[model samples]
Target: MIRPDSFVPSARLAPSADALLFIFQEGRLLLREDGTLPQGHVEDFSVDLVNPLGMLDGRPVFGARLVGEVPTGFMLRPLRGVYGTLSEDLFGLAGYAMQIVEWDRTHRFCGACATPTVRSERETSKVCPNCGLTAYPRVAPVVMVLVTRGEGRDRELLLARGPHFAPGMYSALAGFVEPSETLEHACHREVREEVGVEITGLRYRFSQPWPFPHSLMIAFTAEYAGGDLALQPEEIEDAGWYRVGSLPTLPPPFSIARRLIETVAQGE
Candidate 1:
């Protein structure tokens, strides 16, 4: 697990040896053909496009944006595709870098006013000169619930596939937490809304930073309370209960959904 203490945020833009460069082009991460982070000084590549991410393991880390054309000796990969393959530490760092770059790119101008914004010298934020409004990185919270029913050999897990999911892949029910809603409330509401089923015995499991444009997925395990499966046509394409021994295609092992399902299937 990536701990908060692993990264120390700072505004200083100092380069050092062993520094990891997280370069992105139009949101895709830049990696060598071997699927490893390209290493070099900020000056070796393009310093003008680099942004100070923070310090990792006492080394200064940076995020860079490369627009148009693929540079030699490097290839752009979708951030999601590199999840399970990359080292856990590096993956966490890449996620952190991506979120910072996105926040900085989107907050170039103030929302309160039309004036341009400038980076804060003391913190990780953008400040509007005219209105004095500061913008920080936004992290949207999402709730994921793995709903199961029955017990022993007859126990079955309710898995649902969203319309956008690839092929027959089905996982837990998840949705973003609405404003003025508690995590627990969001869990219940999302399950009811997405699958038209009530869930009880909601137990908090764990959380993962899903940085496909920023989302903190808080996972949970719940018991099916009542109601029948009435899939939300707009969101869910198919949903069903499956016995432990027989299951369809699941999410990738890197995902929290897969972990949650494995926990229940393995009786862990």
Candidate 2:
């Protein structure tokens, strides 16, 4: 429901009334001592660096990097921890800001010529001074699939837990889309590699912007065709089919994995 009218990015620092200041340090977002976004005069924070993100509704938004000691009334918060605590619009904007800041920080130098790069005047990119190589923010696409089998009372969903997931929490199979591979191909390959199963009727569901480090998650619902569970030792900790009556812990509500499961569970 939180939709921005348009995105107009700028490299210059311009503060306005409706401008949002996204200050980050060591990969954590800075918030007020009362756990709220800083909304007053921008000069109070003593920001050292600022990058204009875009315009939302009609106001400019900026991303800042804090250099000095933490401000008197500000605190650092982990980006993931602020997901459900912040409004959807604000959270989405924060994700965008983080990605932009990271891209700027990492691409300060050119990869090919080993020379310092400068920001592009006309776009959100870094141009090499010597080689003229342009580097844009990287967005990795990942595929997620919720596999189901049977119908009526016997219906079951296949869920798997990655090694990094919280204890007892399981979600759909997912993998990064390999270069030169189609999304559908990535979907089929992930299912086979993770759980050793072949999926049929791969139907596209939806996509979500996941900013753990810039991942666009594309979800799907696939019918379980054949093969047994042969979990990938390195990636998958456990996997199984669960009936509606008995399901394990799931990912957070803000995540697309939970939505994909809920949509099929509710017969939507």
Candidate 3:
């Protein structure tokens, strides 16, 4: 918010007079009406949760969730909606801030010993005083698969519509990675469970951090091997293999699912 062009910044620095703030209400970030980060004084607002979000251009960046009504000149907006409106670095900082704020708000006590936890000075974690156990923020990893078969113009993609997806929209098959399971195994399991299909050639692609709460999406491309198109009625409403020329409504461009489809489908 300070927009300092120079200075060394760190995640856990002593707050300075020129510190920048990222405020949120409910789960939405506080911004100006034109969708820029708020740079105004917030000493008047009551905060529900607050935590450091590292540094930007030499200023300590802190995140806070405001209590009660929205402040006078500022507005509350969903973090996703202001993607392009913010600088790439600032956008990432905002998402990370949200996760930290939520982690601090929820992990006030140790889960094991029921003792109040103390903040770690050098790390973003809570240390239990009684048990000496440390609790760090959790990032759940999810696997996304874009199943394909055939080649060239004959190539097709397996897309499915979730129960809550917009009407006529479809995307890649995805599921969270369970404990002790590998990414490859999660990919196969998600596709099989969601659509009852077997796949091969599990090619790992890029990943994206979706911080609605906290989720790391690892994407891959798999070739259809076997199994019929059996939708998991509750999770998936409809599914089918789609060719490039005839595709349904896809996800937003910001999502890894959409990027994964585009990487394979190319011209689509």
Cα lDDT tens digits, model 1, 23-102, are 88777988998888877686677534467878877887888777667778888898888877688888878888888888
Candidate 2's error at 263, in angstroms? 0.8
Using lDDT as the measure, name the better of candidate 1 and candidate 3. Answer: 1
Ranking by lDDT: 1, 2, 3
- Model 3 TM-score on a 0 to 1 scale: 0.91
The window of 10 residues in a row where model 1 has the poorest summed lDDT is 42-51
Q: After superposing candidate 3, which stretches have Cα over 4 Å from the reference?
A: 1-11, 16-18, 40-44
Candidate 3 residue lDDT tens string, 1-268: 1123443334466656666678877679888677777653345457766676666776677788888888677788888877788876687777777887888878899999989888888777899999999999888999999999988888999999988998889999999999999999999899999999999999998998888788898999999999999998989999999997678999987789889999999933
For candidate 1, the per-residue lDDT at 44 reads: 71
Tens-place lDDT per residue, model 2, 140-180, is: 99999999998976889999998899998999999999989
Per-residue lDDT value at 231 in model 2: 96
lDDT values, one for every candidate: 0.86, 0.85, 0.82
Highest TM-score scorer: 1
Q: For model 1, what is the C-alpha lDDT against the true structure? A: 0.86
Off by over 4 Å in 2: 1-3, 6-13, 40-49
